[model samples]
Target: MDISINYTRGQDDPKSGPVKVGWVVSDVEAPVIYDPPRRVNSRDARREHGKSASRCPAVLGLESRYFEIACPFDINIGFDRDKDGRPHLRNLAGTSGPIRASTLGKRLSITNEAEWRYPDRPIIQLKLPYIFLADEPTYITQLDAYLHYRKTPLPGTIFGGRFPINLWPRPLMWAFEWHDVSKPITLRRGDPLFYCQFEFDNPERSVQLIEASMTPELKSYLEHISSAVNYVNQTFSLFDAAKRVRPQTLITPARS
Candidate 1:
């Protein structure tokens, strides 16, 4: 089955825009490295196999479908002292044009920052060129900063949201924690700042919390292995008695 998200371009958006919304090519340049060179030595067969073994199947599953959202403009963000001597965030400069950064109660707003503006918070908003419309429910999440962009850590935490196509009409906000009062950071144009993966929601199923009763056998087992040291020594020892019978396999499985 073919699945797709519909996008409506903003009236003022350029035809040759640098930022992309949905699926994108892997070769695009970004500040972060998502998939690093797994193989260290191409000639060493053992080392090459070891690297392949270390890859996480879950990461590989979503890698190709992950949507990378890039920075629309070149901008600098820095810290400065307010009137009360407390630290605050300020927008230094932007290459694309004048960017506005303002505070909306507890949350900081970045406005004129993008092509499309939100109705409520016009002061600080990301103007996404395309308003994403899906046939079903979808989710958008930020890329892992520690894993991908370790050198240039995001000053704030990334926020994710679940959107139901028919009910939710507004685009997602590019929210961050914005509490780091340390050094300044710069995001160049076309920098891969955000990443998102989508899933189709099942309306038939609703989330619910239910109390679970433990079985007598499970309770007895838990009571018997309550001691941390004893449990580790008996069952989770680094050198186990089972290993003596048949050594664990360290080799990577050969590709089929």
Candidate 2:
């Protein structure tokens, strides 16, 4: 069945277009940032320094409710992979509603997308901050941003440094990059920091859900990526909170 996916700057418009996000990845070339060793504070004033003064800043130390599980009319359409890379069920009559790895294809292309679209609700309200980036202020229509938000980082890591002509190697500060969230543009959240809303169709046809996480490794990656974006944004232009408040710069000429 064909599904109409609509993204809106505001909830009222259905033809606003689907939201999009961007993600970039290249083998193992992404940079990685790590903190230097912690500085040992002197417990006693009269004693000599226990260690040398060279060190980096110590690592700055650092839901939700519910929703329905829709039962699709045809469970076979829900997922399409079995252990032998085959279909386990012929129809929805006898199959369970919950999606399992066994019922998914070998590649992890879009298993979760089907699950998000079963209800046909047309107005799904997601109470999570799943949005990562956007091209427009009112709505999002970039799939890359969404995908970047969903991307997962692999385990291994590496660091980078500069090399000078005079010296074999030069001192370079640490920076971090992720194979997953490559280069995110902007991330926003409400004051409560707990809840946001997503509207899905009651008779949901097609959509996707990507969970935001605070996993130690994921957090580190996000922090580095965000910091990098902030650095760029700051260098290019000041973050004008006023623009958000007063977007209209069109001023009328004063009457003499």
Candidate 3:
């Protein structure tokens, strides 16, 4: 199964490969240490290999199935406020070109119609520019992209949500939400940003990701309803709006 990747941002950079296939050596020129989101690790063997959780098929299967999505840059964001008493967020550090952090506008509000804003915790969107989809649409009957954030060090702070990219055709983007705003949010380059897994309805199926070119027909297919959400409030209410604009039936999206 090939999940077509459009490197809208980092074209050849190894950090934003989006699919973790193998370990990234420490030789890459950078400052902070890069810890790969490997499914299994070969470390110090304290006990004899008689029985262990790591050796179990069921246990290793879960990790092996998931493809890791790594952060492309070293980003440091700090919370701040102005004299006017309105709070705000500032990007302290982020480099290596392409990857960036931005404040999510009011159009994409957390609530339906901004009835209740995100409190003092200003929401920031990680601008990870990459698009993924089951472009082949044959070997994989249905593709579901799930992004989870439990493996990272910042567990309770940075939030994770599922994105049905097969139907949506949106790029790889991240929303940052902090539990306790006291400490700043930081993610070093090559850090595990999200644990991405391509799922199918049948449990016996497996998947592999590959970069593919975006066809003109596929581009039109994606453009049909890609920006439709911005025209409305609350994504749940976009069914009617989507039908009006959706012009193609590339792959029937099972879930989002």
Candidate 4:
């Protein structure tokens, strides 16, 4: 399975052939996927003659392949509430390096819906780049993106989402539910933000993450589906909007 990825700021063409494992025709930065690191086994926890979690297939699979998204820059997140108790979130830039994140790029905003779960709390959206496409027709796979909150357990916070990226080309706009508005939460540059895990329906096929340029047609379709949420209640229901706006001739058949 070759999953192609492209970002909004990426260039459409590259004169240099494909990048070694994948290709990303981006002028600024290509979205990065990493092998999630595992903690080293301490000698004290080792059983001389017994099986170890270090060698367990399930444990290995969890750390094998994933996109480890990081903080774009150092930023502090704080909460505010009005007289009516409607919540608002604010983001302040911390110490930045020579290359600062774009003011718009690092902005985190709270959801505006009044009836949403934990409406009095802040739900912050961290917009990410990289849209995905799987090129295999007979096999099926799944991609899920969520915060690595379990590994970095910050109390009073919820990861807020896990999206099945295989069905749509939507950007990974990560929403985090902050339950505690007491004090601010700060994130330094390079702090791990989330993880995107790709799963298999048919476990036999090998999967590859290839860097690819976004076609004009695909970008147009993405724009249409992404904008649809602004007009509807079920933001999650836009998987249908993806196919509705895409010409039938362009969709690749998936194993249904």
Candidate 3 per-residue lDDT, tens place, 115-166, comes to: 3245645565565444555422212111121333334345234455554444
When sorted by TM-score, best at the front, the candidate numbers are 4, 3, 1, 2
Models 1 onward score TM values of 0.42, 0.16, 0.59, 0.61
What residue pairs are clashing in model 4?
23-211
Q: How many clashes show up in model 2?
A: 35
Candidates 3 and 4 compared by TM-score, better number: 4
Residue 140's lDDT within candidate 2 is 17
lDDT of candidates 1 onward, in order: 0.39, 0.24, 0.47, 0.49
Runs in model 2 lying further than 4 Å from the true structure: 1-15, 26-132, 138-238, 241-256
Q: lDDT at 10 for candidate 4?
A: 27
Deviation in angstroms for 22 in model 1?
A: 7.7
User: CA lDDT of 37 in candidate 4?
Assistant: 21
For each of the candidates, give the backbone clash count. 8, 35, 0, 1
Best by TM-score: 4
User: Which candidate, 1 or 3, has the higher TM-score?
Assistant: 3
Worst 10 residues of 3 by lDDT: 136-145
What value does the lDDT take at residue 41 in candidate 3? Answer: 28
Q: Identify the candidate with maximal lDDT.
A: 4
Tens digits of per-residue lDDT, candidate 1, 69-154, equal 55655557765656975444567664434444532112234433242233322223333422232222344344433334546665
Error of 2 at 117 (Å): 38
